[model samples]
Target: MSLSELFISKELTIKDSLAKLDKTAKRILLVMEDEKLQGIITDGDIRRWILNNGDLNERVELAMNRSPISVYEKDVKKAKEILNTNMIEAIPVLNENNNVVDIIFWNENFNRKLNYYKKLENPVVIMAGGKGTRLEPYTKILPKPLIPIGDTPIVERIINKFNEYGCNNYYMTVNYKKNMIKAYFDEKEKPYQVNFVEEKTPLGTAGSLYLLKGIIKETFFVSNCDILIEGNYSGMLKYHKANNNKITLISSLKHYTIPYGVIEIDKNSIVKGMMEKPEYDYLVNTGMYILEPECLHDIPANTFYHMTELIQHYIDKGEKVGVYPVRENSWLDMGQFKEMENMIERLGVSNE
Candidate 1:
């Protein structure tokens, strides 16, 4: 399809622009008025705006790249050069009047070759021992980690995502319905190596890590089996190593809108100001973490302890605990019914 078909009016709402972006599969849209290029809006722009709690119904211009890189149609060669030199995905071609005439996208092969990540040897520990009380009926027959999303189990999907980045060694902490999880892996002949850490009793999230004191000798990843992070794992690892962080939490941007008007009161119990439904944004823990092997020592053995408690312990000790934030949609939670339905729809899977 012609790139012009992806052009959208700056006045269009962010919601409309998103639809156009998804439909075009171009990851960006040219915001134009009267054939003159106003700005450019990309998926990244929208994600950033959403992270900051920007209203979706607001104009696309609010989140667009007002000074986007562009070149004249005569300078198409220069556009390609810019795309290559800057490692950008696309560039817009404009006319003498600063009007968008065309767009040049980076070659798919170039993108694939340039973006490859090296394989990692660090062991990934998945917390799969939860009772999965939220997904009761399904959990009654199958463990939460074994719950299927599409054709594969949710835990398998999580493992596959990490495997893409060369994380092959896996250590899963299993308690509730532990045998089923181990049996499934035993039956399947796969290239990856998996070791199951069976908990004698219910040990909360971080508690099971105590079992890996001498087992994990390097930096590793820990994740909740029921959740999946679609962001770049290598980037998070890089950040953890670069910052010398003891623990790094992968957080997802979440936006919540208040339905009713909010009132602010003063010390005298008098109203200071009243505003209509205000939206708030937060960085919520996505149950994924990169941690140094040394941190495992902090987990007490044979006791129930949550990951949050471990984080708090580090915080109290003034240790380096960082959070890397990703777009809200990148973190999918399939443990809950609402999020499960959303995941099904997003994956284009039939409910049946």
Candidate 2:
């Protein structure tokens, strides 16, 4: 069955069922009764709820849309037709009794042969020109991106993440001793299409994208050079497409545990609740984004423009900006010395 066809019992509340939904995304079957198809809930559905201000404790039935769209057992042809007609990537298969039987992905089944040669036509813009000032003494010589992560450079790892989704054409924004970066890649003969957009002065993060105004036409991927992402870019793109987002930011869940006991205090030294060593999970940006071509106009030329400022500006103007959360371990930030050491000690062997 398609991941969207499986459903839980009607008795479960939305709050109680959230964990199951996330687990199902990991490929578990969501079943409640004997092969009876109930409406399936997905991560997208929960996010939609949050966006709509639906209460977390509310029953899932209230949130779930009844009469879900489905296809018949012998109707594979119809399913493909429906997918193409609706521009849907996946369709659910149902049996004679209306139970979900399987899922058919159009790209996987019908377009597989064609897709082998036709890569996703999207450019990747990387902000690799920064000097690693935060990385201290290391910044004295090597650029942050060139720092060795086992055999490959940190920037190459970031490029490979986009390449996994068939994005090959790359535009690197270079400044802060640009020759070193050029020399390194020149000596190595990098695998993909690599072009440099030279910055006369240090232009901040999003500033470089302004240089790509004419070169990049469609939705493109932009990422920091010092990050390693384990999440799939193809899936992120799918989410971005489904939402009609102008910009999609990749976020990772980060957990922090309090070292000491924490207390909850009410108005006048009154304790509402008390807990010791509470652990909290937060969604943090992974420094990766998918930007629409139109947004490129907002970036000022030769001026400092950080991604955060751009996002805020868009939000104030009432534009749609979405976030896709990856698991905590999926993000590795090598921008700091400690994280770099941790990356080498823990992930270096694997990267090699």
RMSD of each: 4.4, 5.3
TM-score of 1: 0.78
| Residue 124 accuracy (lDDT) in model 2 | 88
Q: How does each model score on TM-score?
A: 0.78, 0.70
Cα-based lDDT for every prediction: 0.84, 0.74
Q: What is the lDDT of residue 96 in candidate 1?
A: 88
* CA deviation > 4 Å runs, candidate 1: 1-117
Tens digit per residue, CA lDDT, model 2, 1-352:
3454445776677655665644444312233456575565544455567556576567776666455556898877788678666554556688887777687666677753212223666888889888889997877887888887888788887887677667779899988778888888777765688899998877788988888887788988889999887655666777788899989998875667798889899889998887889866566888999899998899998888899989998899999999887655567888887888777775745444
Q: Tens digits of per-residue lDDT for model 1 on 34-137?
A: 87888899866876686576888899999999998877888776775687566557788878877777777764524432122356778999999999999999
